[model samples]
Target: MATLQDYRNERLRKLAALRELGVDPYPAHAERTHTCAEVVEKFDELIGQTVSVAGRIVSIRSFGKLAFIKLRDASGDVQLYLQKDDVAGLDASRGVLGMKQLKLLDTGDFVQATGEMVVTKTGEKSVGVHELRLLTKSLRPMPEKLDNKEERFRRRYVDMNVNPEVRQRFIRRSKFWQATRDYLNQHGFTEVNVPVLEHTTGGADANPFVTHMDALDDQQFYLRISHELPLKRLIGAGFEKVYDLGPRFRNENYSDEHLPEHIAMEWYAAYWDWRQGMRFMENMYKDVLQKTFGTLHFRLGEFEVDMSGKWDVWDYAEVIAQHYGIDVYHTTIDEVAAKLKEHSLEVEKTDSIPRGIDKLWKNIRKSVAGPVWLVNTPKFISPLSKANPDNPQSVERFQPIIAGSELGNGFSELNDPIDQLNRFVEQQRMRDAGDDEAMMLDIDYVEMLEYGMPPACGWGWSERVFWIFEGVTAREGVPFPQLRHEIDEVTKAIYSEAELQ
Candidate 1:
C-alpha cells in the first residue's frame, strides 16, 4: 500500500522526467477555443472542425496504440481521443505534448487539447487530438472521492473536483446574492457600500469582534455586527431608499443556522413602515427565489414552505401568550425563567425579561412552518423599532418565520432621538449586567437621530436564508467556514524542515 508521500514521490519522478524531456510541466499559458460543454453541446455544428479545449484531466486510458483522456472544465466534461500515428510531437516552447509523453500526465494535471470534434467507434462524442499542451502538472493527485467532513472543508478545492455538486451549490449561492441585488435595484434601491469597522458598533444584540487600528493611534475598533447603523445614517443623510450587502462579523459560536462571520443585507425605505416593508419583502422573496431556485415552494428540513401566496401575520405577544401562557408585556423575569427551564431552554442568571421571553418565542418559532409575518414585538426587545401607535408596549417590528427559523427581520425604524437614547441606555445597562450580547450605546447614531432621520422601515437577513432553502448546515453552506486552528501531524511532519510553528 502506498502512502500519500509515496504517491507524491512517484509524481515528482514523472515531473523530473518531463523536465528532462525539455517539456515545461507547468506552462504559463495555454490557448483554448471552446469549453468542454460547448464542444459536446455544439457537436453537430462543430463536427470535423478543429477546436481547442482546456481542462483538468479527469481520467486517462490507453489501449496499446490508442489513448483517450477525459477532460473537465467549469462548464462540463468531454473526452479527448488520441492516435499514436497522428498526434503531434513534443514542443517545449509551445508546451505541446506528443502521444508518447501522455504517460507523464496524471488525472489532476491540467492540459489544453486542440482537436477535431468526432464520434468514437462506440458513438461517444469526443475531440480527436491533433495537439495536447500541458497547462499545469499536479504533484498530488486529487482524491477520486471526498467523503470525510473535516477533510472536505480543509481541502475544498479537492472536494469541489471530486464532488462537482458542491461546486454547483456555490454557483447557486452566487445566483442567490445576484438575484437579491437585482430585485433591490429593480425596485429603486441604490446600493451604497458601508464601512465594516465601527468605533461604536450597535446594530443588533450580538457581541462584536474587536481589533486595533495602528493608524488611529492603535485605538480599538469593532467589526460591524450589522449594516444597520451606517445604512440608516445614509437615510438620515437624505437618501430616500438605500441598501447594502456585505459581510458582517460577530463574536459568537457557530450553529446550524448561524456563523460568526456571514454575508447579510439590509435595506431602508424612508417613508415606509413595517407593513410596507413586509409586503415589499414578500414580493422580493418571490422574485429572488424564482430566479435562484426556479420555484417558490421549498421542503426545508421538516417544513413545507411556499413563498407564492399571501403570508399570514401573527402578533408576537399573542403567539407567546398562547404557547407559554405568559403575557410578554406583563411577564416577570422569574416567570420567564420558570418557563425557560420548563421548556429546557437556557436560563442564565443575567437573563433579562426580554431575553427570556425571546427564548420562549424561539421555542414556538421552531414549530412554525411558515412564510408567516410575526409582528408587534415588545418594545424592550426591539430597541430600534418604532413603538406601535395602537400598542405602546409593542414596537412595529416584523420577522418572517420559515422552516423553523426566523429568516428575516424588519422594523418601523425609531427616529425619535430621545427615545433612541433611552433604549440605547437600557441596552447599555444590559451589557453592564454581563449580558455581552446586548447592544452597545452608539452615541454617534443617537446624534444622527437627533439630526432628524425620517420615519423609515428597515430590514436585514443573512445567508442563513440560502442555507435553509438549500437544505445545508451553516458550515456546509459556506464556501469556507472557520474551524479551530490545528496543524495535522502529517502536515507538520511534511513541513518540519520549514520550522513551522
Candidate 2:
C-alpha cells in the first residue's frame, strides 16, 4: 500500500514529467466558458456545441483508449468523456499528450476541458473532450473519506471537497446572514460596524478574553462579549434604528452549543416596545427561515417546530412553577442552590441569586419543545431591561424558545440613567463576590444613557440559530472551530525519552 509520502513522491515525478513535456503543472491562467452545473443545466441548448469547463477531477476511469472523468466545481459536478482519437486531433505536435496527461492527473488535480455535449449509450449527459489542459496539479492524495469529527473539522477544506453537503451548509450560512441584513434594511434599520476592543465589556453575562494593546500605552482591553452596549451608544447618538452583525468572544467552557468566538447580531429600534418588538421579530424569524432554509417546519432533535404557526406564550415564573415547584419571584438564593444540588445538577460556585435561578429555569426550559415566547422575566435576572409598568418586580423581556432552546432574546430598553447605574452597581457587587461572568460596570455607557435615548426595544441572537436548524453541533457549523494544538511525532518522542530519563 502506498503511504501519503509515496503518493506525494509519485505526483512530484509526474510534475517533473509535465514540465519536460512543456505543460505547466500549475498554470497561471485558463479559460472556462461554463461551469459543470451550467453545462448540465443547459445541456439541450449546448448539445453539439463545444464549450470550455473547468473543475477538479473527483473521479476517473480509463478503458485503454477511452476515459471517463467526474469533474466538480463549486456550482456542481458533471461527467467528461476523453477519447484518444479526439485528443490526437486537438494536439498536432504531441499525438498522445492527452493520454499521457490523463495518466498523470490525480483525483484532486483541477483541469479545463473544451468539449461538445453528448449522450452516452446509457443516456448519461456528458462532455466529450476534444481539448484538455491541467490547471492545478495536486501533489498529495486527498483522503477517500474523512469520518472522524475532529479530523473533519481540523481539515475542513478537505471535508468540503469530499462532502458536497458540508459545502452546502456553509453556503446556507451565508444566505442566513444575508437574509437577516436584507430584512432589517427593508424595515429601515441601518447596519453599522462596532469596535471589538473595549475598556470594559458589558451587555451579556459572559467572561471576556482580555488582551493588552501596545499602541495604547500597553493598556489592557477586553474583547467585546456582545454588540449591545456600543450599538446602544449609537441610539443615544440619535440613530433611530441601528444594528450590528459581527464577531464576539466569550471566555467560557466549550460545549456542543457554545463556542469561544462566534458571529452575533444585535438590533435596536427606537420607539418600539417589547410587544411591538415581539411581533416584528416573529415576522423577521419567518422571513429569515423561509429565505435561508426554504421551509418553516424543521425537526429539531425530538421536537418539531413550525415558524409559520402562531407562537405560544409562557411566563418565566409559571414555567418554573410548573416544572420545579418553585416561584422564581419568591425563591431565595440558598433555596435555589439547595434544590439544584438536590437534583444533582451542576452549579457554578460564583453564581449569584439571579444566576442560580436561571440555572433552575434552564433545567425546565430543556423540556419545553416550544415555538413559544417566554416573557415577563424577574428583574434580578434582567438587569439591563426596563421594568414592567404593571409589575416592577419583573422586566418586560421576551425570549423566543424553540425546540427546547432559547433562540433569541429581546427586551424593552432601560433608558433611565439612574436605574441603569443602580443595576450596574448590583452587577459590580456580584463581580466583586467572585462571579467572573457578571457584567462590567461600564460607566461611559451610563453617561451616554444620561444624554437621553429614545424608548426602544433591542434583540440579539447568534449563529447558534444555524446550528439548531442544520442539526449539527456548534463546532460542525463553524468552518474552523478552535482546537488544541497536536504535538508532532518528533516532539512526542522527545517527551517520552525525557519521561524515561
* True-structure RMSD, every candidate: 1.0, 3.4
Q: How well does candidate 1 score on lDDT at residue 492?
A: 75
Number of clashes found in candidate 1: 0
Q: Candidate 2 lDDT, tens digit per residue, 1-501?
A: 976667777999988887777776776788999999999999999999999999998899999899999999999999998888876432413212477567888899988888899998778889998888788889877888889888787789999987779989999999999999999999999999999999999899999999999999999999999999999999999999999998999999888889999999999999999999999999999999899999999999898888898899988888788767888777777888888998777777676678888888887778777789999999989999999998899999999888778888999999999999999999998898888888889999999998899999999999998899888899988999999977556445535757532
Model 2 error, position 250 (Å): 0.7
List model 1 lDDT by residue over 128-224, tens digit each: 9999999989989788879999999988888898999999999999999999999999889999999998998988989899999999999999999
- Number of backbone clashes in candidate 2: 0
What lDDT score belongs to each candidate, Candidate 1 first?
Answer: 0.92, 0.88
> Which model scores highest in lDDT?
1
Question: What's each prediction's TM-score?
Answer: 0.99, 0.94
Give the range where candidate 1 is weakest over 10 consecutive residues by summed lDDT: 492-501
User: Candidate 1: misplaced stretches above 4 Å?
Assistant: none
Lowest summed-lDDT stretch of 10 residues in model 2?
A: 88-97
